[model samples]
Target: MRPQRLSDVVGQQHLVGPGKIIARMVAAKLLSSMILYGPPGTGKTSIASAIAGSTKYAFRKLNAATDSKKDLQIVAEEAKMSGTVILLLDEIHRLDKTKQDFLLPHLESGRIILIGATTENPYININPAIRSRTQIFEVKPLTLTDIETALERALTDPERGLGKLPIKLDDDAKRFMADATNGDLRSALNGLELAAQSTPPAEDGTIHITQAIAEECFQRKAIAGDKNGDAHYDVISAFQKSIRGSDTDAALHYLAQLVAAGDLPIICRRLMVIAYEDVGLANPPAASRTVQAVQAAQQLGLPEGRIPLANAVIELCLSPKSNSAMVAMDAALTDVNAGHNGAVPDHLKDAHYAGAKKLGHGNDYKYPHNFPNDWVKQDYLPAGLKGSEYYQPKMNGRFETQLAEQYHRLRKANQ
Candidate 1:
């Protein structure tokens, strides 16, 4: 059943749980303009539906993938007169800058409670002006537990679920189905329904779905080149691993396969990531060279672009590799995610603003440029994170060699 209430909604606890911002908004009936950003089938639309269902407000839906300015204008006019209108804008990034700009006025005026959904990051896809005007909440992908619960409800709920059908799901089939769905509830349910429909009746007169039956029902292999399809991730993984494993031959093979399949840009990007992540400072040239490959591909366009791509791949395969840089960045990002954010140091605080100096913004700040050899000790990081080294450059090429000499000199001079 399409859940009619928030309690019935699966996943998305951070937004709808007790005392959450959205929950408070719903209770007070103060639903404002918001953008829900996440991957497909993460219940962005369902959240909008729940909000609309709870109120005596007008509900209008528009898919930016299909709707034009005229459609938006019609909705805007209706919203202006209505007490409250929950306008669902799906794939709003499909709208050009001009069209996105057009919605800004209505959103700011509070005429429409904008509930925009995008699979892409809105900051990258949406106009900054419009993005600033709306509250953005990211919807996380559904977990396996969430999918299992939804499937259980679907199997038993007589009114809108599969209770009417002669279907029986074994534990293995249910587990496989959940894994295959990969957090997309719509796909999971669709797969289950398809399997149930195709499954033959068992001796007990119920349609029992097995692993083989499920696979047979969904056997049309999704093309490996389709970016929005299942093959996209698999191909990219194969390509990156081949390079990382120093298999230039296999790497070239996958590269050619991607090129022949016409997904050249994706291949270029995968190489770029490998350059930075796999090769890194062990050979800084890898990243520069990977960038050049992308530029060459853009310039020569196709057949000739293959030359630079090949050269870059071979070079990266032969180069000394290190993940030190990548590891440092990832570790720092993990800390940020864990909410270990420390405050800015006083010396590092901006002193350009009026009265900033009076507030001790730059008190005791040391100018490294004025010090001997431009080397001085000062609190570069926040007080709480003092002596916390994020980037411990490995002893490798240019970065390591230079850093080693500097550290030696600094130690001797300070002593």
Candidate 2:
């Protein structure tokens, strides 16, 4: 019921194609435990099964969600009896500590070769101990052409497919099914089977499948994402990074993915953070615009809200990036954490009350407005930290460049 050869596996050519990592390992019979991660129905299980079949290894499939520790024991025992066992663990991201503890020894001993399959990002969900022992390959979504090919294979193949039935599917119907499934071959195949089986045969004993039947069989494919899962974080992270990296195209792509996932609040918050943290003083206006956009998104809500969010994302991505403010804050924090708590200069201390003048507060504090250019050379920092320069703005954008120039001129004049 699944692909027996790597060559027959649809999509994920990056891992299973000729001369690819999986193909090379299989060809050399040098199998290693690995994790296949991606969206649902992307051949994770099929690829694992194919590897097991090709290598002639005893294959066992277990669902991490339902399978207990005893199931792992059985697999381990079987592996001990029969050289090695290829264990395909589904929902591996949900693997508990107890199961991980039980499986680690067998994995290290080569008695169990784990093929972990997860719809979540393993790096974010799986235990590092388990992850370190296996190679991780991301299986991509199947293209429409790939889905069509698989559908065709299922339609004509006699033994495991629907070939036994005299079914006639129109070209448009095939395209509809392939496109409707949204790169999920399993959905496409299931829909095909449904249409073939449910439709009554005509006088010629041939079951006719039309686009309407295909649509009825399969609903629109839901967006391949969970708002609270690894995909959510991954997409948001990509969105922020793309904006920071100033890749408008990539930023928009990730933004769309998040919007499709319906996590508008998270996207809005992340955009605000990106504007200030990444786009900082380089374009202060961008940061203000990002705040306004987030406010607009909050007020407008979904569907319409995405408009302002998109505007903010594109504007932030195009804006000049500068991390000098972040760097400066971090540098200051580093000094503070490293026991640099020098007392504030007496003159700089608050001296609002009448008695405060007796403590030398504001005794010699020079008012900058009283001097030429509205600036004055004064030791503002505590004595020991007078010359310590935490903020060194980069000449990246017009605003930061002007600030940097003024900063240097002030430092020189003060010296």
Candidate 3:
């Protein structure tokens, strides 16, 4: 059931709590268009509706991906008559250019206090025009305590929630629902409803929702998500760490958990990242194979796709790990970002132009390929960073060891 007041909304205290941004905005009567982004069942819709209810404004909810431009025009027309209307635009990231252009002027005039909602990150997926005009607020997953509170509220509230029904939710069943939901309050409520409706009324006319009933209502998700879904982010974090730590068993365990949750894309993407970020230059070939494996997994889909993914995960686990490449690149980036850049040497500058010789470009440049060893030592870095070194080989793998030997030899030759 949707909440009519912010007080009834669960979790997301950072945005809706009494001194928070949303609360402060509503208090000061200075409502600005904002975006609420997070995973499913995080109360993004509830907050939007609650704000509208509290402000006594006409609340309109529409999916940007499914609703037509005419649907938005209807809301705009209503806003024109009502002075201001609160619109909860779901899947705002999918809003097309035409619909966005139509809504832009209304948002600008404060006639439509748009509350855009999406599971995707607004900064990455939303159009710049809409994003620039709206404030972005992240709705966090509901905690177990938060879910329990909502469940209890639903059980007792006579209106909106299932209160009139004689439902008895056991403590174990309530906890099971909360833990199984993985912070998704909507899933928990839906599962509870299914259990309540499916179970036969007891002799006392009470619908008993026991732990077994909860499990049965949840089906495969109940048992499979027992260990994984409760801590989805934790499982993902542990999955990468286990691989990086070379714990093949632990890594595979987490992989299985992610698969059970049906998060193939996240698994594939994370595996690719782990290949480069964790099992990096120490074994370049392994990293390359990980990318190929991710591509194969994407094509194959789950079940069969998991086969190549398993191979990649195991190889990455056993592969030698080195962050030397990542570290070196980060070091260079840090300097560049901090404005450590200096003027390039004239000899190293482009010398293909007609007046190159006159400008002293490439005049003193030595052609390394023409030298005795097919190499020549020269200042390639800018004058201020002439002796700067970034690449530090860990030499964990044979390939890196050999490369390190050659690298040190060349440095010695120059010295």
Q: Rank the models by TM-score, top first.
A: 1, 3, 2
Question: What overall lDDT goes with each candidate model?
Answer: 0.79, 0.87, 0.88
Error of 3 at 236 (Å): 8.4
Report the C-alpha displacement of residue 289, candidate 3, in angstroms. 5.9
Worst window of 10 by summed lDDT in candidate 2: 220-229
- Candidate 1, run of 10 with poorest lDDT: 220-229
Judged by whole-model lDDT over C-alpha atoms, candidate 3 comes out at 0.88
Q: Determine the C-alpha RMSD for candidate 2 after optimal superposition of all C-alphas.
A: 14.8
Between 1 and 2, whose TM-score is larger?
1
Window of ten residues with lowest summed lDDT in model 3: 220-229
Tens-digit per-residue lDDT, 1-415, candidate 3: 7889888789999988989889998888899999999999989999999999888999999999999999999999999898999999999999999999999999999999999999999989999999999999999989989999999998998887889999999887888788777789999999988998899999999999887788788763433444333465778899999999999999999999888756686798899889888878889999999999989988988888889999999999999998888898999998899898999999999999899999999999999989998999877788887677788888789877888889888877766
Question: Model 2: per-residue lDDT, tens digit, 99-172?
Answer: 99999999999999999999998889999999999999999888878998999999899999988999899877
Pairs in steric clash, model 3:
none
What C-alpha RMSD separates each model from the true structure?
Answer: 6.2, 14.8, 7.5
Task: Judge candidate 2 against the unseen true structure and give its global Cα lDDT, from 0 to 1.
Answer: 0.87
Candidate 1 regions with alpha-carbon error over 4 angstroms: 68-82, 96-109, 127-129, 220-279, 285-323, 326-345, 370-393, 396-402, 407-415
Better of 2 and 3 by lDDT: 3
Query: Candidate 1 overall Cα lDDT vs. reference?
Result: 0.79
Q: Considering TM-score, which of the candidate structures 1 and 3 is the better prediction for this target? A: 1
